[model samples]
Target: MASDDLFLTPLNALHLELGARMVPFAGYSMPVQYAGLMAEHQHTRTAASLFDVSHMGQLRLSGPDAAAAFESLMPVDVQGLGVNKQRYGLLLNEAGGILDDLMFVNTGEDLFVIVNGACKVNDLAHMQATIGTRCTITPMPDHALLALQGPQAVEVLKRLAPGVESLVFMTGGNFAWGEVPLFVTRSGYTGEDGFEISLHKDQAEAFARALLAEPEVKPAGLGARNSLRLEAGLCLYGNDLDQTTTPVEAAINWAMQKVRRTGGERAGGFPGADFVLAQLDGRLPTERLRVGLIAKERVPVREPAELQNMDGQKVGQVTSGLLSPTLNQPIAMGYVRPEYSIEGTELFAIVRGKPVPMTVTKMPFVPTRYYRG
Candidate 1:
């Protein structure tokens, strides 16, 4: 890809002015960190942190047959989703491979969808080609996305948009901030209580600037975001999950509603149902899937590290691995055989040609702080 093809988010100028270290990720020029990774990470855990997620794709799907049309593409029971409620789902190829993971919201008049920044273009293009006839798909190119994450996120958002206080997790509401229409969702990727707001791109910089005016709201970047999600036991596409992985093995089997799996009235007519259903019949082969690793040392274990058995036999590979700022120790996520996936199961990681001791530990190395109320 050419440098000219790099995408820029609405907050690009603000990020640069703040001395953020810019890096190319997911086809966009984004901040990897500002004011150091450890400081930003700690700030978010203790208070609120502002994140520019404008690069993510936001779309509106509508038509009289929208729900029915969308059901043909995803496994989620869209017809049952209450208005303004958000549901997590995946877009699968004909072979049942995960084309992309996304969230869909029932907005009374239309369905609002958000997809990963890196996969948005392909996701949008594919949707147009497949479901265009049944539903109208429109990309919200003029919008900007922002995440306010941490324990104090609710309080921060409440002061600005009082309506946010009533919005529960996975729910969204429209509000006004000085006449600027804002869509706030009490949802986030940080494993903490927070909200993701979508608004016009022209208003992003001013909105971000106003949010940062708060002492608790500091600008955070991709580096801290990655460590935060990994610590939350969340999967990062292209690493923890991909086309080769299935929902069952990815530890997301819970996502597949039983009604859809049992071939009820809405049975297994979707893609890859034959093999996927067959696996659901009996004990699945214990292949290496998503698992946590507790590194024995302070040094962080990067991705692609070779994981081996007690006898030095190769078992699996590390996908998303990093040192935890909150844990004060190294933590990693990878795939390992069912036998080796047991918590406390000891294994070795070859880092720089040295066998490093590691053990399987329950993921979300730290407890999640999502609001239960």
Candidate 2:
């Protein structure tokens, strides 16, 4: 049942027409599944899948000091990002806590940023309140975001819009789908070879239907999106990360570029730089580190489940977990004390008051299939 207060994406009507099971997520009525969770999950692994991500916030920052000003807010190399190149970033507060994880692209003329749906309002306010005087902050709520992800995504997209196949990971370019304009980037949250296409909200359903016409493309929903991301070991904002977690503690150290680190040419200017950089450089002590876990048995250990050692003392808690559709094994990611963060360390997940034996493992239980070429 669609609620009156929940916002609807551009494709909301089409989703209902396709018999999608809708659910409220991030204050929007989103499709949980169309065909089914397992079916959509496996289809995305083997073929291309279309996801409606219009609920995410898209905004632009443009000015003479855009890159430099944006860099001062996030702990990433924003000024160093080449034109048309995209980079992952963490928005931090003064206390070194993550406000949100975002993806921003340097499009030569302006910075195009995509933030999580739930935190979009706050993210915009924070950016505007902090750097609005230095740059022009414009929100693009009229743009609809869609992700076409899988190994065959290139083949499906290139047939509709030529030259998309030439794009590599973390890069974007402007293209046209018939008369409609598209801004596409070779990236995705599913850890697959894919593209995130941005277009006008009015043309979204038409474009989506065009993609669906392809034999290789099927519409997936939030259910499979969550499972796919979990299997890929990607962090979910409110689940695996929040205001209480730092980048180092979340184990996403790669998002912080070298230039933002302690001894680089342009360093320690972003929020909480002293603390975050100290942790990154190993000068500051970290209490817990994020780790991957694999269950010994078939039981699925889910989020908020307490982790315990052999002595029955709680050492951690599961943040994300599911029975991986690709690997056919239960896998999870959680924060654990430093000593228990190493691979091959045995731990127990207290599910339903019974300990489920598990072993600390490496992430990407299913290897990422990014198209770097």
Which candidate should be chosen as best, given lDDT against the real structure?
A: 2
Question: Which candidate tops TM-score?
Answer: 2
Q: Write candidate 2's Cα lDDT for 1-373 as tens digits.
A: 2368999999999999999999999999999999998999999989999999999999999999998999999889998899999999899999789999999999999999999999999999999999999999999999999999998999999999999999999999899999899999999999889999999999999999999999999999999999999888899999999999989999999998877785766877888888888888789988999999999999999999999999999999999998888878888999999999999999999999999999999888889999886
TM-score of each: 0.96, 0.98
Model 2 spans > 4 angstroms off: 1-3
Per-residue alpha-carbon lDDT of candidate 1 for residues 5-117, written as tens digits (9 for 90 to 100): 88889899999999999999889999999999889889999999999998889999999988877777776678778999988887776656677888888989999999998
Candidate 2 lands at a TM-score of 0.98
